[model samples]
Target chain A: MIDSIKYKIQICCGTMCYIMGGAELHLLNDHLPSNLKDKVSIEGIPCIGKCDTKEKHHPCVKINGEELNNATSQKIVKQLLTLENNDLL
Target chain B: MTYYNNAVITKHELLVRLIQLLDTNKLLDDIDRIPLEMRPRTNSPIRCCVHKDRAVIKYKLMALLGFNIADEQHELTPLKEYAEQALEGYTQNGNFLTVVDEACSSCVQVNYTVSNLCQGCEGRPCQVNCPKDAIMVLNGKANIDHQKCVNCGICQKACPFHAIAYLPVPCEESCPVKAIRKNADGIEEIDFDKCIHCGKCMTACPFGAISEKSQILNLFNNIKHKKEKTVAMVAPAILSQFKASSAQILNSIKAVGFDEVMEVAEGANMTTDHETNELLERLNSGATFMTTSCCPSYIEFSEKHAPELKPFISDTPSPMAYTAMLAKKRFPEHKAVFIGPCLAKRTEVYQNQNIDYVITTEELGAVFAALKFDLVKTDDSPIVSKVVRPESRGYAASGGVTNAIKTILSSEHNITTELIDGIDKKSIRLLRSLPNKKVTDASFYEVMACDGGCINGPVNVSPLKVSQNKLKKAIQEIQSEEAAV
Candidate 1:
């Protein structure tokens, strides 16, 4: 069951994002609960170009292609929990 | 690790906006709109009101424009006038720091206050511990007498109820030299003679009241006008700053309008060689001990606070100084810019003739944001050098200097070394006491003002642990590549 379900988490490694708190989001793996450990895969991607938009939220993250702005470790984990709950149902 | 608080975010936002305006040649025309734009009427106020918030932003922009708040000739002077003056080469009088009085929270004087939890207990330790008899039992609670209290913090510790609270001004507490204090208006003021420009106060202020005068606009103006060939001499600490590789970051900096990029680590090699010789010479000549003079803030501290230690400071030039010299010899017509995570370097540049400007790592991030350079996607521009030592690259972390010198002097002599990781009140006292102590154990002393060295500098972007891990990995990779060759 763990092998069948995997969530994709792409953390922005852009300069603006990295400085604005994206760097800490890279440590989301360490922060994941035991239940969600094998349920998610994290990768760092280059700038997603959201910094130039009218709504300026930096250090962005994308979980399963859903954009998360002003990303933090706890916020990402909370989103992951919801995603995992929906997928299990 | 530095906290990404709202103050830091606002500072970066202002920098990016100002640089963006300068890029499109609309800075002078739209400079005044920045305060209003950042604090529109619709948005809730960050301070007391929108007007106060806008006023603070305006003063912060003035500092970003390289003008001190004290430089304003009139109350209604627009930011565009400051921008105009900056473009016209108005000198900043070598002052790198300024206080945004509008933003200053005017924190109350540092003192101990007895909270309601104070029980006026049977032990009465608070009354007993008062050196000045400042503590008294009022009704059923303990009270501190403001008139007699010296703020020694004895009663705060003696209270069994743990009710006494010590309130401190963060900036004053962070300063090593006691350089900043509350003025008559309660706003903080820095004594230039006492300040070594370590920038601790700038980082410690929760309100972001202290600001460094930025040279970003002046640099942008030069690059845009093609006034002179601009060469960026990046410090070794930069390798740990970004997530991308060193080559990619260098290329990205080139993309930011620098004509040439030179690694200051190359100059660190020169420092190692000269310092090794100086240490050997001093040791052989029967001198007690010698300290490394690489840290600009440490050097300034020795000059202003510890004058007697001057004779023991090594005469070897810092990596920045050597790199700027090499830059001048190679690019005779270029204006050399030393890019690093240091505020004291601005003061260092004022004394050194070869270097023309200094920019912190935070300002560099703003430049990248304004230009919208994708760092990882940028083309790799590897440094072209005959010999690049891994030891020189290690100079970004604490004890790296001693390790480099040890590698060279290991076989010849068994020299003892001591490391002063960071400068603070306790470290200052130790440093001052060093001269009086006889028969010291160490022959070499390495002093870094910022704990964990330049990678953990006040203006650094990345976390200290992240930087340390990255730097270790990068150095190991360099060692392996050298081994393969």
Candidate 2:
């Protein structure tokens, strides 16, 4: 149902992101739902520099255009699942 | 059980980053800043603080450089200088695995604790049953004095409300041989004598305190400085690890500067040829059966725990050693580099005459990532193929050895088979009771230390299903392709 929204999950591979477990999210490429493959794209971007700003989110992974704090394996997968299940795929 | 653990991922991430620096020839100057640069300037760190996280990373970097954590460095030495020293032919000694003391969580030692549910009754069975008077009632609650407590657990049983609960350290629980134990400081220590190097504790530690010393930098130095060509002996278990077809994996391995790629499954084919003949010889002579000794950890386990089964273990060399020997036979001056799943393979390299170095599938992934080479994206340019037989290719899974043996078994004298998937306390007990087993006439035994065989090995980074699919595809591709060599 939410297929119209183009989603891009940007994993921060910056120095800060790597420390906050951003490098670990590289495994997400394997865990992503195949059906949702058409809806989302995964890419590793160098620190968006948002982490060094006043926002204070270091391990943030971007889903669509939204930033997620504490973007660990569990949280990121949960967020992805919600997006997939919301579309009811 | 699921192998996806946070600590394990964190450990691998560190290794990959260290390797990236080494791959680019930037490690000498940039190695010191890696831990600091990765340390977060803002937000939260996984440890207590960014400093603490960096401290752990420092030790991890040391391990990636191939130094045991227990080794003492000079007070005036920089890590870069130490790296230079290591490259200058510093001989390594001490344990295979190391504990970064600063990173250890130092959990409490008490296994059993008295909960608040104790009613403080007049007939305090917990107090009464305490042989050493370790338990006492106070303020309508029960408390155990750890000083007096010998950990007999009589009080735990006597408690009426089931208030006493037992807590175990994860690494200790995961270890089959009870090799990992807490020292006086509560930091886990591995008794090198007792360790089988299965690498369960390395993945089980929540703090990422325990790690195997890496062969990456050493491997890099070997390839860069050595006059001899470096040949990669890729394991059968590696079938599940890479996303590329076997043909592509062959090219991808060469992409990393390897001179040759040898299929370890080809070695497995040889091993099967020998193992099958051995089994027939033994069974025909009225011997009960023989066990497959392809798994180095299984061989160690059988030698240490099941001494009686030592004679029964097939005397065949492992795929890694066998393949390396094959490579050496072809090229007299080539250095054999084994890439596979188990950490025990690292230790196995010590006894190996043909193999020069061994890296896990996890480590290979790190090297690939560091070098920015994607196995799946690599073009299928088949450089060399040994024409691996389909039966030996099946050795990646649990029953692969059984099937390989079945192919050659003479159907002589009603031979039977039993299987042990994973090594744990229960499996060890079963192994002990094998001779006395009355339920089944299972004379022949196949025991794999890691559940589901080498694909499910402790260091294999890929998830079970993903690896399995990739392995199947690679086998099919390899089967169809003809060997140019």
Top of the candidates by DockQ: 1
Model 2 misplacement above 4 A: A1-89, B41-45, B73-76, B88-95, B114-129, B138-140, B154-163, B225-227, B410-413, B435-440, B479-485
Which DockQ-derived CAPRI band holds candidate 1? medium
What tens-digit string does per-residue lDDT give for candidate 1 at B1-485? 34657787788889888888988999999989999888999999988899999999999988878777778899899888989888766585766888888899998664788888877788899999899998788798888887798888888888878898988788898999999988988899989989999999998888999998888888888987788799999998888888887778888888888899898988999999999999999989988889999999999999999998998899999999999999999999999999999999999999999998888888888888777878889886465463668888899999999999998986859789999998998888877877766766698999999999999998878778778977886677567767887
- CA deviation > 4 Å runs, candidate 1: A1-7, A27-40, A84-89, B116-148, B480-485
User: How much lDDT does each candidate structure score?
Assistant: 0.86, 0.73
Error of 2 at B88 (Å): 4.7
- For residue B363, model 1's alpha carbon misses the true position, in angstroms, by 1.0
Report the TM-score of candidate 1, chain B only. 0.94
Q: What's each prediction's clash count?
A: 0, 0
Candidate 2's residue-wise lDDT over B357-453, tens digit each? 7778777766665565645567776665555787777888888888877887767546688888988899888777665544435767888888888
